[model samples]
Target: MKPAAILEAALYVDDLAEAERFYGQVLGLDLLAKAEGRHVFFRCGDTVLLLFDPKATEVPPEAGARLPVPPHGAHGPGHLCFSAGAAEIELWKKHLEDHNVAIEADFEWPRGGRSIYFRDPSGNSLEFAEPRIWSFT
Candidate 1:
């Protein structure tokens, strides 16, 4: 079977409201749905981004209990990446820079195109990569 692409990524944050403000207002993700104090969902192209409160207690038993967030400076692999064309990448770079978002780096691959790295208010590493990264066989 072919590998299925990721449909969504759930980030456990200290506050869902803050996540909504950052991802929705700051980063400008299209808000698709939300449940107060529990979670918020955004539409990233065809994929979904789910933000949840780390302290929320409404999860089903089968979903397990919520856990505390890791202390600062402890590294983790949780991140969300967006794919864009070269022009779209530039547009996002300008938009982010104009909004005073700190850019971690902007790098180009040997193949073609480039990427920009940044973080959300919750410190989740977000990457916007050029779609051409996958164009080559």
Candidate 2:
């Protein structure tokens, strides 16, 4: 059976508080949860963004109690692209700039859409593109 859609995406960060501030305050994503020094979760539309601490999540927990889903941590920077309406693209760029986030690059895709790329506090590459960028509709 084919999967419906992505439920969550994970990114490893060295600083959870900084991630929380950047995502929740700067990016305006809803803060779903934060597990102290372990991880921080944010709601990105229907999907969830999970930021975990590599050092905390990479090591398997001691015997006895264990997480239902074992931690799967990643290292280095990651990338996540979000869909935006054509008219909202400019607004998004302005919003990002207003928040002091630099636009790494902005491009008009040959296929017929535009995208803006930027980095999160942890250096994960984040992108926002017109829905048609991937021929979504």
TM-scores vs. true structure, each candidate: 0.77, 0.93
What lDDT does the true structure give each of the candidates? 0.77, 0.90
lDDT of 2 by residue, 1-137 (tens): 99999999999998999999999998889998999999999999999999999988877767676564575788889999988987787899999999999999999999899999999998999999987877755
Report the CA-based lDDT of candidate 1 relative to the real structure.
0.77
* Regions of candidate 1 where Cα sits further than 4 Å from its true position: 57-77
Among residues 3 or more apart in sequence or in different chains, the pairs in candidate 1 whose N, CA or C atoms overlap within 3 Å are none
Model 1 Cα lDDT, one tens digit per residue, 69-131: 333222343677788877888899999888788899999988887989998777878899988
Q: Which stretch of 10 consecutive residues in model 2 shows the poorest summed lDDT? A: 62-71
Highest TM-score against the true fold, candidate: 2
Clashing pairs in 2: none
Which 10-residue window of candidate 1 scores lowest in summed lDDT? Answer: 68-77
In model 1, what lDDT does residue 72 have?
27
